[model samples]
Target: MASRWIRPEVYPLFAAMGVAMGICGFQLIRNITTNPEVSVNKARRASGVVENFEEGVKYADHRLRKYVRNRSPEIMPSINSFFSNPERSN
Candidate 1:
């Protein structure tokens, strides 16, 4: 009787949602456990917050600056330069 209301075609959608929810739940638990900002005690939390903030700033600066400096401005450089020096087919 329960199966009558739930169509077979909808099973995959339910499975996908379950997997997505599971992944989200796992990440939340991992972050709560491992993140320094969420310290076990109040005293440590303050220090952790400051230290993590500095680390985050440095990391962001290095990653963003490096990528911006090194990456090509063109969207598809190779394709864009295809006809730049075309060879005569004769």
Candidate 2:
């Protein structure tokens, strides 16, 4: 009898990993397609509008501050102070 290269016990593990990867890939595709921000950024990059780390950080900070301001008024002062002087907070 010829012996199989892969053991039978490992088949379930491989299948589970494959399923997890597929789910992750599907979620990534969904996000890329559904999010207008992502598409806009891609278009900007294609048009030679290069995005650097500092710009990305500033954008994220702006978005975070806006979200925090809307959802929780009490935390606005702390968030504002932190952004104003990030070095002291850390």
Candidate 3:
């Protein structure tokens, strides 16, 4: 059970605490492990590029879908061709 009268400011404080705890836990694990630097560095390096490319693809697909939704029927073929262009193909 929770009280409805709780101040909204408390939510952010709790959220921050949760994030801080998570970061501290991660650092603690990193400090106690053997070869933590190598494993963490490798993971970070791989994740950075992978996350960026994934985000780009996700946003591009989102924008393309939105464009298609708003597009006139007459321009459908041209739009499809533009997106399917070999130069831009992934």
Candidate 4:
């Protein structure tokens, strides 16, 4: 029967590659956390848009509600029964 273990020569190569990848990952995380240019909040504030996550969500919800309200009366019945009565003609 043949041995299923990896060859010993490949272990050092794998170790070296792992060390290099670890160093790169550490540098990437350091750059992201310390760099203001990568920050979403900073970018939004710089553009004079003071809305936070909650406010942005609220605005989106308001807009969606307004659009649905305006269009519902005209389109609601068909939308509601689209799946319920799939046999109905288009």
Residues 1-90, candidate 4, lDDT per residue (tens digit)? 235566777889989999999999986885566443345466554776343676455534654587676664655686778867878946
Q: Which stretches in model 3 have alpha-carbon errors above 4 Å?
A: 4-7, 35-90
Off by over 4 Å in 4: 1-5, 40-90
TM-score, cand. 3 vs. native: 0.32
Candidate 4 global TM-score:
0.39
Clashes of each: 0, 0, 0, 0
List the candidates ranked by TM-score, beginning with the highest. Answer: 1, 4, 2, 3
Clashing pairs in 3: none
Q: List the residue pairs that clash in candidate 4.
A: none
* TM-score to native of every candidate shown: 0.45, 0.39, 0.32, 0.39
Between prediction 2 and prediction 4, the one with superior lDDT is 2
Residues 1-90, candidate 2: write the lDDT tens digits: 325757888889999999999999986985676543464465665766454667466545655577776574554778898888999999
Q: Whose TM-score is higher: candidate 1's or candidate 4's?
A: 1
> Superposing all C-alpha atoms, what RMSD in Å does each candidate have to the true structure?
6.6, 12.7, 15.3, 14.1
* Local error of candidate 1 at residue 38 (angstroms): 2.1
User: Can you list the residue pairs that collide in candidate 2?
Assistant: none
lDDT of the candidates, in the order given: 0.70, 0.69, 0.63, 0.65
Report the error of model 3 at residue 12, Å: 0.2
Candidate 1 structure lDDT? 0.70
lDDT of 2: 0.69
TM-score comparison, 1 vs 2, better candidate: 1
